[model samples]
Target: SIEGYGIHGNSAEWSIGTSASLGCFRLHNKDIQKLFSLVPVGTPVQIVYQTVRGGIDLNNNTAWLEVYPDIYQWSNPELESAKVIQSLGWIYEPHWQALGNLLQAKKPLRVEIPRVIKIEGESLDIDGFYWQQQVYLSQKCLEVLTVNFKTLRADELFSGFVKLDTTDLPGGNSQYFWDPQANTLRIIRLKVLLNGMELSDAASWSSDHRLLMNIKTIAAQLNAKFDWDCVSKAAICNEMKLVGEPRDGVFWVELEGLQRVWPQLKSTWDGKNYTLELMYKKR
Candidate 1:
C-alpha cells in the first residue's frame, strides 16, 4: 500500500494543503500536465518522512534550513538535527573554509564585492578595469585615438576597435577624435605629453573618464620600434618585451607593463594633468 506514491488526480481538492493523501500524492491537473511534459520518465522521486529540508539559493547568496512537525510520526526525532546539519554542509563548507583561512592568517579579512553596472535600468556585465572607480571603454571612444587621428587599421576578424601604424603626423594637435567614418562622436583631450609636446591623438579617456592608451602608440611616438607577434600575442618595442594582447580588434598594453619594459619612462599625474617624461640620447 505504501509503494504507490506516484502523482495522481483526486476528487478531494479541499485537502490539497494537508496530509490527507492515503499513499498517492495528488496534484491539480494543470500542474501535473506541466511536470509530465518537463521531467523524463526515469526521474527519481524521494518521499522522505522527515519534516526538515535544507537548500541554498540558486545565486548562492542565501541559505536556508527549516524544520516542521513530523505529522506522520514516522521520523526519529533523535537524528533529525544531525540530518539537518549534514544537509546544510553543501552550503556551509565553502564559507567555512574561507573564514578559517582568514583566521589562520592572523590578519584582517577584506572582501571586494563587485559592483553591478546598469544603463538606463538595464543590467550589463562589469568587465572593465576598476581602480578608484570603474572604467569601461566604448568602441566609439577607443576609435577616437586610432581612426583619422592616427594611422591605424581595424582588424577585420575582431573589428570592434582599431590598430595603429608607426607613421607620424606633423603640426596636428596632440588630441584624439572619435570618427565613425560616416559620422563623428566627440573629441577627447590628451593627458600625456612627449618631449614637451602634447601627445597628439594617442591617449583618450575611458568610459569611466580614466586615461587609457596603447603602449605601441606611445613607443612609436617616441621613435621606438614596435612590433607585434600575432601568433604569440606579445608586443616587442626596441627589443624590450611588454606583455600585450588584442581585445575587440585593438591591441593594448598596461601602463605599468610599459614601465617595466622601459625603466627610463617617468610619469606624473597631478590630479588634473598627466605627463609622461623620458630622456634618451638622439642618434
Candidate 2:
C-alpha cells in the first residue's frame, strides 16, 4: 500500500515531466484506478537499489553501494591544536629570545658565553642559552638581546642591522623590550661645537663601560648622529680672532667672531654691537 504521499502530478517535482520514480513503477491517475482493483491483497513487491549511473539486480543478488557525503579530507596543520607555538610572546621579545631554551617542556638547558654579563649585581641563571649582550651597562635588568642558537664564536660586532641567515633587522629594534637595565639612556644632538667631553657624555660610552662588569646587563644599545656649527653661508672673511682654552670640560664658544657671535645684537642695540673672529683646533 502507498501509505505516504510524495511530490505528485506533472509539477516540477516530476523528473523529465514523467514518472517520479526512484526506478519504482509510477501510475497515472487512470492507471492507478484500474490497478487498485486488480491487485491481490498478498502480492509481494520488491525494490532494487542503484547508484547515480549503475543499477543493482535484486534478483541476481549484488553487493551494496558506497555513497559517501564527500570525497576529500580537509585538514589544516598550522591551526592544529598541537602545532601552534606556545608562549610565543615570551620567546620573541628582545630580552627573551635567548631564553627560548628555558621554555622547553622538558629539562632546562645550560647556556654559557665566552664572557657573561648582568645588570647591577644580579647574576643570570646557571642554566640557559646565551642571550645577546646588553650594550647599555647601567641597565639593571637582563634584556633578551641575542640567542646564539647556532653558536657563532668567531665574531661579535653589530651595526645598523643584524644578519639572520637570509633577512636583515634594524640594529636595536624589537617589540618585546622589558628594560632589565634600569638606567635611562641618552642620545646625542647637534650643536655649534662637538667637543669630545660632551660627545662622550651623550654617546654610548657610559653604557659600554657599565656593560663590561655586569654579567646580564639589560639596556639596549643604540647609535645615532650629532651635528655642530651649522651655517647657511658658504664663504667667510673676518678679523679680530678671540681665543679661549680651559683645562677640562668642553672649552669652545657657541659662535666665534664678535660679528658672528652676536650678529643679531646690532638690530637690538644703539649700534654698540661688536664682531670678533676666532678659530678652534680641538683645544
Candidate 3:
C-alpha cells in the first residue's frame, strides 16, 4: 500500500548517499538502470541502516573500525563501536579519549586497536598511550619533573585576578589573571628592564577546576610550529601530528611535542618489552 516510494535515479549525484532524500532510496542513473535490468518488477526490496562498519584485513590480521554519522540520531556511536569491537574478540584496547575526539568530528574514522604500553626505567607514576606512531603522556606527569603547574578553583576567581607560579617561559616571567567582568583569562608577560608589559587573553578554567585550551593555542604561546589539516582534522605540533584528548583529570600530549618545552626530556620505544622508556639527559 506504500505508493510513490521506489528506488529512483537522482540527478543530484552528490545527494545519492546522504540523507537528503524524502523517504526514498536514491542511486545514480547508471546504477539504477543496471539494477532494474537484474531484478524483476515484483521483486521485494529491503533497506537497512548501519552506524558502525567493521572489517578485518586478511593479509595482516588487523581489524578496522569505521564509525559513521548517526544520521537518525537514534544510536550512540561510541557504545555501538565498542559493541562491534567486542564482537570481533580483539584483545587490544582503544584510547577512549583519542576515539572521542575523532568521533566528535563526525567524520568516518578508521582506528586501529591500540596496544598496551608501559613506561620503563622511570619511577614516575604516569600512564601513556600510543596511537599512529605517536606516544601521548599524561599532562600532570610533567609536574613530577619539576615543571610548574597551577590549579585554582572557579569560586576563588570571583575577585577576577590571580598570580601564577614562577616558570621558565618567554621573558623569564609571566602572570595569569582572570577578568570576571569580561569572562576571560589574561596573561601578563614581564621582561627585565622593559618599560611596557604585554597582556593577552588566554585559556579559561573548566567547571571541574581544570584549564581548558586547545593544542593550537598552547603551541602559539610556546612559539612552536603547529599546523592543522582541515580535510583530516589532524592537529600537528612541532611538525608531528598528535592524537589525544582530555580524560580523567588531565589531557595527554605527544611526547615529542613535550620535548620542545624541555629539551632534556627523551622518550624511546622498547619494542622487545612493548614499553616506552622516558628519561632525562644532562645538557
Candidate 4:
C-alpha cells in the first residue's frame, strides 16, 4: 500500500475537484464519514481519470459534454472529446469550427444537437443520451424496451454493440453489435474483460453510467508490469516512466504509457486536431 495518500475529509471545498491536494482525495467531512462506515476494510479501490466528462443535464434531460483543462498537457482535448463521443456510438459530424472557437475563447459554452433514437429499425419517440459507451434512456423508453421487447432490463440496457472476445464470457456465447449510423444500442449480453480475463465484478459504476476499472488489474491482465515509486511519485510500467500525482492514495498516470504496450493504438495529428484509432490484427 502507498503511504501518505488516502481519501479523507478536507475543509477546502473550493479545491475539491481541482488538483490541489497533496496526495489524497478529499471529500466533505459528512460524506467521508458516511463512506467510511459503509465500505469494508481491505476493499480494492481504483481511480480512473478522463479529461472529457459526459452526462445528461438532469434539468433538461439533454446530453452534454465537458472538456476539462489539460493541466498535465498530456492529451489533446478535441481528440479526447471526439473519442468520448465515438465511444457513445454516436455518428454525427462534429462542429469543428464552433468547437475550435470555444476552445480558443476559453469560455463556458453549451451546444445542443438534435438527436433521434432509432432501435431495431423502429424509431422511438424518446429522448436519450450516450455516455461512456452506454445509453441513458428516459423512464418511458426504459419501460417500453423492457416491457415490450422482453429482452433488456432496466439494468441490462446498454449500447447495442460491444467489441470483446466471447471466450471471456460465461457459457462462451454472446452477441453484441455497435452501429453508430444505425442508432442502436442494446446490450444483449455483456462481460467486461482485459486480455481475456474477466473483470466484470471488480468494475465500478459511476453516477453518470461510466464503468471504472482498476489500472493495476488492467496492467497485470495485459502482461505488463506496474509499479509506483513512492519517493518520486512516478508510475513505471514496462520501462515507460510517467510522473504521477496522488488522488486518494493512488497514483494517476497519463495515457501515453498505453501506446507503449498496445502497439495497435495509433494517434496522428494533421496540423489541426489529433485523431486516435485502435487497430486490430486479423486472426
Candidate 5:
C-alpha cells in the first residue's frame, strides 16, 4: 500500500532518504542521479507524511545544530584552554603539543561538538561540500598515546592507567626473566636459580607452566585493550623474570595443581623506541 501503489496520477511520493525513501523501491534517473549525488543542499532534507511521520519531528522538538568544517576560525585555538589529556581518537603528537602550549600561553582555543541537531534554535548554512549534508564541527588536537596527569605523583594513578613501569626488566638477568610492561620480547626458559639447582624440578615444573600460559595470554590480550581483565592467577605465576630486553632473553614459571599460564616474548629497548612489553602477575 505505497499510498495506493504507483500509477495514481503521475507521482505522489518523492521520498528520498534523509530518512525514508528506500521503501517502495522504484528509483531511476540514473537512480535519481546517484541519489542526487549523495546529498548536501540545506542537508536536513527530512520529509515524511506518515508511517508515524517517520518518527515525526519537523524541527519542533529542537535538534538541528550546524557549525560545519570552516577550520578557518583559526581552529581549536587551544580547545577550552588545552589540558584535556585524553580523547585519543586521532591527531597525533599530543594535539600538536597541545597547540604548542596554547600558542605559548596566549590562550583561547576552541573545540565544540553537538551534531547537525537542533530545533529550538534553528541555524543552517547548507552547501556543505555540495550537500553531503554537513553535521561536522570537529576540532581535535593534542594526541600521541598521551599520559601525564600534570606530571603525576599525588600517589600516582592515571598516567592513562600506569602500566609501563617495567622496573628495568628484572635487572639484566642470567636467569629469572619474563617481562613486557609494554614490549621487549623476553619470552621463556624456567630455571628457578641454577647456582645450586632446585627450582622444584619436574623438568623445571613442566617447562615453567608452559611459559606461564604464554605470559598469561599476553596479559589477557593487552588487558583486552582496556575493557581490562588481564588474567593469570595460578598454576605458576610465582614470577619468572627478564622483564623484557637485555641482549637476547628468556624467562618461565610454574607451580601446578591445575592452573595454567603461558605466553612469552621479549625485546624492549626504551632508549628511544623498540618496545613490546607484556606482563601478568598474581598469586
Candidate 6:
C-alpha cells in the first residue's frame, strides 16, 4: 500500500526530487495518477543510475568529462574506475600530450589567424637607394615584393670579375665561388660585368622562375661568403644564418631571410615597383 496508490484523501500531499519513503518508490500525486492512467497492469519497469558523464561540443571545440559524488553508500572500486574511464573516453592521447607540452612551454594557444598583410609603401628601397627594376607583390613570392637583381646593376655597387666554381649534385651541380684574396665570396651571374667589363654572353637563372638570379649568386657577387649547411638546413652568410630548404629541386629562401641576415640591406615597395638599397654602413 503506497500513499499515492489511490485517489485523493484529506491527508494527501506531494513530495519529489528526493527519497521521501522508507520501503516504497514514491512520486507526486499527479505524476502517480498520470502513470496509472498511461501504464497497464503487469508492465515492466527498469531503473538506471549514473556516477559519471561526458559530452563533446565540436562547434565550440570544447569537451568535458565529470565525475559525481556517490550519493548512495555503494563504493565498489571496479564500478568507480569503470565510470571514470567511460567518462574519459571523449579525450585522446595526442590531445593530452599536446596540451601537456603547451603547458610546459608556458605559451598561450593561438586559434585565430591574420586576415590582412599591410605594406609600408611601394618601391623596394635599401636605405635611400632604390633599384631600377619594378618590385611586384604576390603570395607566390618568398617575400612580399620580388625584384630583378639586374635592377641593382650599377658601377658604384659592383665591379671586377669574381670566379665561380661548380660541382655536380643529384639533380644538378653544386655551384659557388669565393674571392681567393678575401674571406668573403662575391656572387655574380649573367648581365653582371666581370672585371668591370662584360666578359661573356652566358647568364645564370634561379629555379623559382621569379627572382632574376639565385640569391646565392647575388650573395657571392656582394662579397658575402655564402654556403649551404646540410645539418641545419639553412644558408650561412658570414655570421648570419638564413633559413633555407630545397623544394622540388629548387633551394628556397625567403627574401625576409636575406633581409634578416643583411642588416645593411633595405627595401620598400611602391604600388608598382620595388626599391632596394645596400647601405654599407649602419644608419
Which is the leading candidate under TM-score?
3
lDDT at 35, model 5? 63
Which pairs of residues clash in candidate 4, taking residues 3 or more apart in a chain or in different chains? 25-248, 160-185, 160-186, 161-177, 161-178
Which 10 consecutive residues of model 5 have the lowest summed lDDT? 127-136
Q: How far in Å is the alpha carbon of 201 misplaced in model 6?
A: 49
Worst window of 10 by summed lDDT in candidate 2: 211-220
- By lDDT, the better pick of 1 and 3 is 3
Against the reference, the lDDT scores of all candidates come to 0.47, 0.25, 0.51, 0.48, 0.25, 0.37
Cα RMSD, model 3: 19.9
Deviation in Å, model 2, residue 22 alpha carbon: 92
TM-scores, all models, native as reference: 0.30, 0.16, 0.45, 0.35, 0.15, 0.26
Report model 2's TM-score to 2 decimal places. Answer: 0.16
lDDT of 4 by residue, 13-64 (tens): 7888777987788998999899999997567788766667555454654456
Q: Return the candidate ranking by TM-score, descending.
A: 3, 4, 1, 6, 2, 5
Q: lDDT tens string, model 1, 18-87?
A: 7687667788877888888998765888766655555655453444444555666777532553465466
Cα displacement (angstroms), candidate 2, residue 188, comes to: 2.9
Best model number under lDDT: 3
Those runs of model 2 whose alpha carbons end farther than 4 Å from true positions after fitting are 1-182, 191-237, 246-251, 256-283
For model 6, residues 12-108, the per-residue Cα lDDT tens digits are 3444334455534566666677877888865665655654444555564344434444557466423553454456553322122222222222122
Residue 56 deviation, candidate 6, in Å?
4.5
TM-score of 1: 0.30
* Candidate 1: stretches off by over 4 Å: 1-188, 204-211, 247-250, 274-283
Give model 4's clash tally. Answer: 5
